[model samples]
Target: MRLRDYLRINVWLLPIILILLPITLIIFGSSYLSTPNTYFNTQLNDGWSVSHGDNHYENVNLKNFNLGNTSKGDVVTITSTIPDMTAPAAAIMFRSILSTVTVWIDDEQVYEYGKDFADKNLMLPKHYNFISIPESAIGKTITITFDVTENNAFSGISPVYYGNLFELERSYLQSKRLDLFIGIFLCLFGFMLLTLSSYLYMYHGQDLSLIFSSVISFNLGAYILCYNDLFNFIGDNDFYFCIMEYVTLYSIPFSIIVFLVSTHPELNTNLAKVFLSINILFPALTLILQLTNLVHINYFVTALHIMALLEAAILLPRLVMNIYRRYQSRKNSPDYTGMTSDSILIIGLVVFIFCCVIDIAKYNFFNEFGGGGVAYTGITFMNLGALGFVMSLFVFYFYHGIEHINAAYVKEHLEGLAYTDPLTGLMNRAKCMQYMATVKGNYALISIDMDNLKPVNDTLGHLEGDRMIRCFSDILKQAFDGASLIGRTGGDEFLVAIENPESGICEKMIEKLETLMAVFNDADKKIRLSASCGFAYSNEPKLTDANSVFIMADTRMYRIKEQHHEDKLSKFLDDIISGKISQKGGEEGT
Candidate 1:
């Protein structure tokens, strides 16, 4: 996980928030429990005159009260060690609209009422007696005339406890820059990983690799947007925010291109080209308008952010269809069928995207759902969801890569086992037909017969005759490879198919077979064989064309065989044996 990726993923909070939740409560125990402070020891005398002071204010009117008074506009401070509570997600709610402000031990004056500091970093501080001072009552800095002056003052303390945190953190935490960097790095890292995986898939045709690569790439773009601080360090925050928004929006469309390229039928290289060409110009335009203050909307950059998420959600149904089709084609493996990693990844991304949309809607458009009557601010939450989804994407990709490896293994074994003939170790008729269907353009189908093999099978051992047939098929396979798809169509008959017969592939095969025959029937050999081949070619469809191209070839072969004299089989075999030469010589001749 790189810093950028983490920012991209979390954007608002830490990754391990579930674990951190409890720890947060322990540290900020007082914040969760409605403070147990009783105004006792320090007594209060109502009014005082602070006709002068420095900073931001002068004399101001205030409601007077006693030491035990607990009302609006009361200024209270922690005089002793505060009591600790288990729950951290607690807040002191004032009656009406009062810009809630928090006075932290670190001198961090956070606005609890106004829009500025509504975004919270912690859920609740478990221990500490938080003095709730409503911002509505104080417009100016008044003097602390008496320990207890205002009607809402509480000087002493007593114990109290009301559990269950009411407020949820709605905003993304703008904490340490390091946290943001981690987030941004992780997303970018994921992007890099995705690019690597894409290359792997392109070369090796691995689905998992493509998916993993896509996820990483998506995260990378996201993280780049998240590392706004890094960008700000170089320039302006608003400028940085604009670039981030454009990138975030662009990633949505860009990811669609990547997804299609990785899985689309017929492979859509053009879509990627189109998106790349278009989007390269978009970010610059958006950034320029944003920097010039031309687009001064508070959540101007947010529109694109929401759009990206919406698009992700929209892509899910199409992906589901792809999964269904893939399963139909890959029917045998029911257990490993349909919508694997890609589906899961898309689902997670969609949910995360949707959540982001909600976040934007609540904060900017409408706050109807929950928290702050809009979106809750403070204490990171959505970022956790994003991180969770990212992790899921990682796992999905890892598994997908494994699946590709498994598929390659299965393909290799199947090619060796189910397709190749055991007897001649050549292609069976079924495999031959399959190969024949794939050949394009003008091609030849040939039938070869080894004469005298049947008689030899009856007179000598069938095993020896079988060996003779095997030898002839082996010779034929080597003779017509560039020109042939060879198979044993019968006990003593073999078939060969080749492409682009205009190159004289048929004649070359026959000539090469004759050479192989001579080598096979050496002086030391037991039984010699002679082969007859017949082939036909046509631009227009023959009765079989490619389907029965072999049958037509067989007919021609038989015509040649019948014309020979009865004593010719032995002589023909003798001629083949005598003419054949060394394996090296055959190679050189071919």
Candidate 2:
């Protein structure tokens, strides 16, 4: 097989290894009783009796026992004899799926977990249970009875082990290491998702997919915290633990669906809505049952699990169809390349389904795979599956976020191009009109016309004319860089809107223009540059239209151009008359 195929197989094998390795070490490492001589240590799997809800059984081994959605109260009794009289102390270590447990040794109370049956308040750690053996009970027959009650968990009972006190303690701590490792990994991963979500929100306008992905991650982390019994360290409220589990479990499907919709937007379906409604409805019903004490929540959880399976069955086919349709569409399109979102989502869902199927099989068909009845196989697969789904979702969110940002950038650049003039790189007339139509308050509009642009183009070349227009545009931008708007209104006409300019600034601007023209004419003897400019401002509180002011300024500019034409004509007549007088004088001299 190729390396990638090997990697995939390895990933599937990892969870099984994680579960089995620690359990094997704990079981074998603590198998021998700690003593100066040879001693006997036993796992109390046989000769157990269980009674719950009018049902009774005898000689029930851990493998033969099943909880079966029973979450309220149960009793388990184990009768065993110490084979070695020389052994000093025997201790029992076991993990319990029950929320509350009370133990008695030969009718003498040994350990108590909670106050009473209905006192669903304090919760003992599910990772390990260590019960110390008294020195007085040496060489005696021990009858151990366990009073157990559970909440929303489907896990039934853990096998009991008897060994030396020191050996049992070591085994208890060793067994907890795996759960600790998984919990820490999940918590850190969830925190990373939260951090990424914040960055996406700030930079990418808070994409709903990323936000929902973060929520899903946090919910998963919290669920793991409760499931692995880490929450007992913070607080031992059984009711709160159950409620947290309910909330997290109820929110996961909705959050994932929301994330999916927000990422694709095309995959929104009635089935997703139905799944969301089922998730919400069941949790609310469970809460009502909790409040009314009508039924055990485990039965409700069983129903929810069935509904989840149905949802997965329905959702998986629809998702597959969506992937096929999207793939076909992209295959015909020119721009399609690389892995698509639907493809990634399908991979994730497939992995999740595989893991869930394994878990279901483990829970039903092969419950005694590892000899010890911890049911770690199913739980391990479930957690790994959830993590796989979460990682895939993160991948989707990352790509989706990038696509959104790129699209926004392209749109903004296109808009910038649309409002810009091609020749002069200035605002076009459309932009000018838009600015005039929306602006308020005091503003001055300057209308400018090239005086000799047509003559320059006709006598010289259109290139020179364009250069003149460009020069005028540059000068206008430099003078009115902070103006409200500056744009090319016509071929040789430019407009500028000065925001809140003083009355004297306009006159000073006109003087500056004249000075610049004189300098240009002196430096470039081949061409003379000049322009006629007019400006107007209205500070009236009820100004009707700023474009009207622009019209007035344009009219005034035309009037100035007409006056310059008349002045040039008069100068030409004077020069002609002077030449005639000089000619007449020269003729008299001859």
Top lDDT hit? 2
lDDT of 2 by residue, 1-590 (tens): 43233434555554685588557645543534323323445667776666655777677776556645444455555555533433446777666555555666666777765455437433333445567776566555655444555543433456677777665554444455545455566567777877877886788685656667778777776776676656654575655776677667666666766666676655677767776676767767876776676655544544656676777787777768877887787664433434555676678768877886776666654333343333444356766677667767766655454444544665666867988888788888888888888878778888988778888899999998888877777777776657778899888888888888887777777777777777777887776878888888766344468877887888888899898999989887887777965776789999
The TM-score, computed over Cα atoms with residue i paired to residue i, of candidate 2 is: 0.72
Off by over 4 Å in 2: 1-74, 80-91, 98-100, 118-128, 134-142, 148-156, 161-207, 267-272, 316-346, 364-374, 434-445, 483-485, 497-528, 536-542, 559-590
Candidate 1 residue lDDT tens string, 1-590? 43223324552443475468546534443334333333211111222222111212212122221123233344433211122333344332211111233333223342333223123211111112223333332222221111221222222222222222222111112222323543565567676676776777689666653564455445544544443333433443433443553455545445544655565553444544564455445555655654564542222344455545544454555556666677566655623423455655666666665666565554443232232232122113335445546655665665466566566766776887888888898888778878767666777787887788878888888898888777777777788777557788778878777666766667877888888888777753678868888887745365545666666787998886775544576776676788644544788889
TM-score of each model, paired residue for residue: 0.48, 0.72
Candidate 1 weakest ten by summed lDDT: 121-130
Instruction: Report RMSD for candidate 2.
Output: 8.0
Report the alpha-carbon TM-score of model 1 versus the true structure: 0.48
